[model samples]
Target: MNGLKAGLAELEALIAAPVLGGCNLLVCPPATLAAAFAARAAGTHVQVGGQDCHWQPSGAHTGDIAAEMFADLGASHIIVGHSERRTDHGETDAIVKAKAEAVARAGLTPILCIGETLAEREAGEALVLIERQLAGSVPEGLAALVIAYEPVWAIGTGLTPTVAQVAEVHAAIRAVVGPGVKILYGGSVKPSNAAELLAVPHVDGALVGGASLKAADFLGIAAGAA
Candidate 1:
């Protein structure tokens, strides 16, 4: 919903700059800009991705983009089960799993999102619920994948969990997904707290939101990954 061709030019230069900390960067722009951005990002460290995709390769599901379409657009990865989609579209873990499977079939990686709502966290069911979602949403035998832990309550709220809180959930996720999977911490992640949050055990990377819209902020966060 943000960024146009004009904005892409700025992003192109920033993303290509040397100060990006050598971290893996992926941009998931609106569908209209995916092809354009992917073309610009070629041969650079920045990879392009999609916000969402349908599980079925082709169907009458109008207004829904399929995994194959994302691959066709040169997207190396697609996000599934984001809290926004789960809450706004009523997507369940079963649906997320199917979408992940479709992404695998399309020869693209899937970044699966799993997190708890504020009420769930308050009720002390965060780990229990996240584990349930993991079991139901993650597909078996994916060559490459990423999992993002974004507490629904923290997203866009400018409120973040304590580092220990993030570590607790990440550790639980590690136990379930095993050692090889990469777990990301999302939810209001800004440069100020990026270093501390990234230092937490099992926190592989970030699933940045608003901060990613600005190259300086995004790079600052990447720099904190060290």
Candidate 2:
């Protein structure tokens, strides 16, 4: 939602970067740029995905984008249950679960996002809240499942959890979701902090935000992951 098509060139440079081993670089732009991004990323290590999608395959959903449409547009993944979607659209865990299933139905992967709000965190219920969201939002049988834990308080605020705090929640997520699933931390993940966050145990990767808009910053973070 923050970018215009002309700005695509900034991210297009990512396509030319050497494929870093052990790092799976991906860029999930707003729906409008998905196909164009996918076209540029074809045969490269970078994979393009959708920011969000609707649960229904097709119908009168008005402004809502469908999961199947993402796949048709060459998107390999679609992010479901983002905090913004939850807050702005009043999407519930059940709705997120349905959307995950919808992404799977479209033969695309689902990056199911779950997190706790500032109130929930200050109430000392962050873990509990996330666990509930995880239980309710994630569907079964999602192989190579990707779950992004983006604390609502930290997103785009330039505020991040301490390494120990991140470790604690990520470990908790691993305990419940098991070891096979990949869990990513998503709050304020800038190049400066990406290395530390990626180094955290149970922190499989990052669901980068603002920094991703810049090629240098995003690649620097990818270098850390690599």
At residue 92, give the lDDT of candidate 1: 97
List per-prediction Cα lDDT, in the order shown.
0.91, 0.89
- Model 1, CA-based lDDT: 0.91
TM-score attained by model 1:
0.97
lDDT string, candidate 1, 126-214, tens digits:
99999999999999887688999999999999999998899999999999899998999999999999999999999999999999988
In terms of TM-score, the best-performing candidate is: 2
Q: Deviation in angstroms for 128 in model 1?
A: 0.5
Once fitted onto the true fold, the runs of candidate 2 whose alpha carbons sit more than 4 angstroms away are: none
Q: Put down candidate 2 lDDT per residue, 158-199, tens digits, no spaces.
A: 889999989999999999889888999999998888888999
- Runs of candidate 1 with Cα error greater than 4 angstroms are 19-22
Deviation from truth (RMSD, Å), model 2: 1.0
Q: For each of the candidates, give the backbone clash count.
A: 0, 0
